[model samples]
Target: PGPFAVNTATFVGYNLGGFLGAAMATLGVVLPSFLIILIIARFVYNFLEYRTIRAGFEGVKAVVVGLIFAVVLNLLEKNIFGGTLAFKNADFVALGIMLFVLVLKLVFKKKLSAIAIIVISGILGLIFYGMFPL
Candidate 1:
């Protein structure tokens, strides 16, 4: 075959081996995660309802958040803002873009889907990069 084509919208139009290849890959990747999630769910039911476990989880969540915040702050301070804004322009421009997004999210105050954001960002990146090659 010069070109392999399959109707993705129709389930019955595809081959079994191709379908099983997808299913096998999915099973290989997800089985361990599914088992882990099942175990975590069981643990949540058993432990999370209690005061001690609840507090411990809350503290753990806080620590994780703090770690992420610190990483973000470090990135912004070092990479985005840089040492001297008067000398550098690209870092300042990136920092401005980050601030713009943060302001947009804050002003909108609506739950935005990560998928939609990612898709839009990727499309915008492609358009900008294609239109202005520098």
Candidate 2:
């Protein structure tokens, strides 16, 4: 109901039918996934009992983790390392903040919560970038 991804469907629906269209579009997008999950829920417990299925799921989990790691690496390369954007000017401030946060996290070994990291990052951004006259 609240995912940002749903905004695409809602936008299309609004363009087509206004509020009613948006509602319908949202329902159209959500209902199938909801129904699919519901249908799968009945068999999930029994399905998990199979060793092959469990192994397949484990493989899927590994793939998902790898994909997530790849995305993080891609973001770091593009944004922090200034891959393409370096042609214009690399945002050294952002790079510094990223390195600082990465080092802090590595040093602390995630003793910091996500909220704490976000707050610290925001403050660092303010100190480094926001406070400066542009």
TM-scores, one per candidate: 0.49, 0.51
lDDT of 2 at 128: 65
Span of 10 residues, lowest total lDDT, candidate 1? 1-10
Q: Which regions of candidate 1 deviate over 4 angstroms? A: 1-19, 81-134
The root-mean-square deviation over C-alpha atoms between each candidate and the true structure, in angstroms, is 9.1, 5.7
Question: Would you give me the overall lDDT of model 1?
Answer: 0.61
Best by TM-score: 2
- Clashing residue pairs, backbone N/CA/C < 3 A, model 2: none
- lDDT per residue, candidate 2, 22-95, as tens digits? 99999988998899999999898899999999999999989986996799788778865765553244566456
Q: Which stretches of candidate 2 lie over 4 Å from their true place?
A: 1-21, 83-134
